[model samples]
Target: MTALLTLAVLATLLGGTLFAVALDRAYLPLLALFTRQRVETEAPDRLNRDLAPAWYLALAAIGIAVVPFAPDLALIDSPVGIVIWGSCEALIVLTVFLHGWSPNAPFPLIGAYRYAAIGLPVMLPSMFVLIAAALPAESLSLVAIVDSQREVWNVIRQPLGLPLFMVVALAMTLRGPMDYADAADIATGTSAEDSGAGRAVWQIARLAMLVSVSAIAATVFLGGPLGPVLPGPVWLWLKTGALMALTVWIGNRVARTTPSRMLTILWVVLLPLSFLHLLISGLIAL
Candidate 1:
């Protein structure tokens, strides 16, 4: 199961990386793998800076491991799998913050603080959304969540769930509109100091997190691997890939707002909507 999960992760990551690279950028990750150099930082937290991407990648792996490629099949099928995934989402904010803060540069610190601010609020909606998603299933298990959708998808049951969760996804992966951590304006933001092999690893870790979030999104809202004729894993792959593309596309097109404005929108608007969504989903589940 672990090997199978690893393959799935690799395949999804490859697909997402290709899709992202094909749109509006050259392939630099491979080249970075060969090059090795970085500008010196003044009194940087070497340990955290060096380990941040690895931690991010590990979180992605753990999150994706809970997603069932087929019914009852996953690297980790904990009864509270959704909760475990949620924990990963929460930890991602810290990991990304560490990525920025440990660099000990102005831009990186700013990017780290910005992401932390956005990421903290995003978690409120995510909690409500995830709970709403689990309501119909009446189980925190990802497999049971998939099973609940055998009759009808949670996308229909909880209309606001996926869109709201997308905020969490974008924040978690630092992609598209929510990409403050590596925004170009700040010289790649949190990664402003990154170069060569290190940058490559960071890029891969970001993509891996993207793939991980897309898989969880597919499972929670899109019926996971449920389908006819095709194998369960195939169904999962198709859904996950489609979602990864959608996330990247949305990220590319959505106009980014200033951090303060985004925070207002999230708290003043999206957060309340998630509460309503939870109420509605609970009623439906009842």
Candidate 2:
């Protein structure tokens, strides 16, 4: 378990690296589509941008390779299990913050602020859900949670758990309507400065990494790598891909919401939903 978790953490960090690279790549088409429209803002410096592309890609690839070690990592049975779980959430939060701050563009900066602002409320509810889900075992090790879920996914056993985690995961992963960070218009955003291969990396590889990590979260909290016939890795990949597709579809099909309105909706609607799930979980425990 210790080893597996370490691998997952590494994979998660790699996801961040890939996301940064892919973000640069994905912006090209957008730039081309809206050139000279005031939407095609120039990047800070070409040299830095060019240099970063390859470096970030290497980081992402290393991250993916690191994923397989998760199941072998330390279990959440120790006194620090809860602390470890919180750290996972923190690591993700920190990555987004870096993405926002590291860029020399207005949009990335604004996007970073938005990312941090919105993250606060959503993170609280999600943590509560994780605690409730793992409370039964009195440990925060994901391996132990999976072992407990032999008969049922945590989502099934604790109805609220899945929804709460999903809500936060959506925000953390910046999927669907919650993607205010790089919404095409608002700030011109995180992907604003990327071009050429940089844009491609952001669009494809970065999206792939996000999708993969989100899927793993689902597997850990929901029911990892589960299915009949196919092996665990295969099942995990399939489920992750499906969720990624959903996120992309929503990003494409839906109109981007203003950050203020989006945060309001998340806190007002999802917060209650997550807390209610916690209440239900407590009842189940009793």
Give the count of colliding residue pairs in each prediction. Answer: 0, 25
Candidate 1: stretches off by over 4 Å: 1-33
Top of the candidates by TM-score: 1
Q: What is every candidate's alpha-carbon RMSD to the true fold?
A: 1.9, 6.2
Quote model 2's TM-score. 0.68
Q: Can you give the lDDT of residue 44 in candidate 2?
A: 52
List model 1 lDDT by residue over 1-286, tens digit each. Answer: 6786779766666775566555426476456555677666889998998899999888888887889988888778899998898799888999989989997889999999999999988889988988898888889999999999999899988889999988888888788888877777787789888777777788778877877898899999999999999998888878877888888888888877888899999999998999899999999999
Instruction: State the lDDT of candidate 2 residue by residue for 120-172, as single tens digits.
Output: 66678777777777766555655565556667777777876655565565665
Point out the worst 10-residue segment of candidate 1 by lDDT: 17-26
Candidate 1 versus truth, CA RMSD in Å, comes to 1.9
Candidate 2: segments with Cα more than 4 A from true spot? 1-85, 200-205, 226-229, 250-255
On a 0 to 1 TM-score scale, where does candidate 1 land against the true structure?
0.93
